[model samples]
Target: MTFVIDRYPCEESPRLGAMILLPTAESVPRARRWFRKFIAPYNPACSVGDCTLMISELVTNAILYGRADEGWCVRVEWFREGTSLRVDVHNPGFPANVRLRRPDADDAHGRGLLLVDAIAESWHSGPSAFGGTVVSFVVADAWPA
Candidate 1:
């Protein structure tokens, strides 16, 4: 599994950072840690805990359902938009497969998006510019006044 992190000078842009990860299970935690570290210095007013959880879920989904093969990696990017932070996860999987569903209580899987919908200020999934699908979410009032 390969990991790539890109950092931008804060003075140059509101773009926080981005990461490219192998579409594997291990990428989930790494994504979460990277997000925490990058967002920390800004002291975002949004709940870091919630953001962490949502990121975890999105990365997990990218690994599980987005990748077409080992060659197709997942990319995560975030930027500051006013007082909000927007995160986008890209994978080489079909956008049509990304959806919100009511999972049965007895089911053991398929709850990722449910949690995201509950936590994010707004979220959506669609075709990515590069290819495949991109799932994105926003955390409102992320930056402090």
Candidate 2:
């Protein structure tokens, strides 16, 4: 059997660390697991339940909306730039203007970034120069509703 999914969790983790690479579908869970693993080591009472959701939504979008090929990759980088936790999800997609649309009452999707905007402390997107889109955000120790 050929395996298409793989994950490489860092055993040498830090309170403020980073993960820079792509992840397969199976690694989504691992990504969330690491969220808790990495944060709990420093902040035992951390509340990142929503962070996991954002990660899944962002990562899944890259895998689904982006062109698939052997070169396809989703880079997940997490670190603390100050009093906030930052997560950057990068994908190999030709730079296209990303227009944010307000979803209709009956719309089923297109609200991921809206949710991200509401929950994350701050968020933004840009090109990584490697021809990939880098969407970054900061998650405060606690995000207000």
Candidate 3:
């Protein structure tokens, strides 16, 4: 599996960081670690725990549903918008398949987006510029110094 992270810094804003994963189950933990480390210094309203949980769920879905063949990958992007921390996950999967479904009590799967909806101030999914699916969420708190 291949991993790529891009850090884009703006003079007046928080650095925007992104990662591309190979869509393996391992990528889920890696994504969570990356996100936790990146946001460590930029305090957000949501706890790091919440953020990482969301990351895990999103990356898990990507690994499970994304096209992981050669040259295809799942992408994770994050940045600070004012007091809000925004995270976006994209995968080479059909956008139509990305949706929230109520999971049954005994079902272990299908609860990812439901957790996201409960935690994020706002969230959404759609087609990416690269002809894949993109899911994003925002959590707001205090601004970093």
**Which one is best on TM-score?**
1
lDDT of 3 at 26: 79
Clash count for candidate 1 is 0
lDDT at residue 39 of model 3 (Cα atoms):
67
Off by over 4 Å in 2: 1-24, 44-46, 141-145
Can you rank all candidates by lDDT, best first? 1, 3, 2
Candidate 1 deviant stretches above 4 angstroms = none
lDDT string, candidate 2, 98-143, tens digits? 4456999899988887888888878887776556677777777542
As for lDDT, the candidate ahead, 2 or 3, is: 3
lDDT by residue for model 3 over 55-97, one digit each (tens)?
A: 8998898878887446678888887777778888888887889
Ranking by TM-score: 1, 3, 2
Better by lDDT, candidate 3 or 1:
1
C-alpha lDDT of residue 4 in model 3: 83
- Candidate 3: residue pairs that collide: 45-141
lDDT of every predicted structure (CA atoms): 0.88, 0.64, 0.82
TM-score of 2: 0.73
Q: How would you encode candidate 1's per-residue C-alpha lDDT over 49-108 as one tens digit per residue?
A: 898898899889998887564478889988888889999999999999998989999999
Specify the poorest-scoring 10-residue window by lDDT in model 3: 37-46
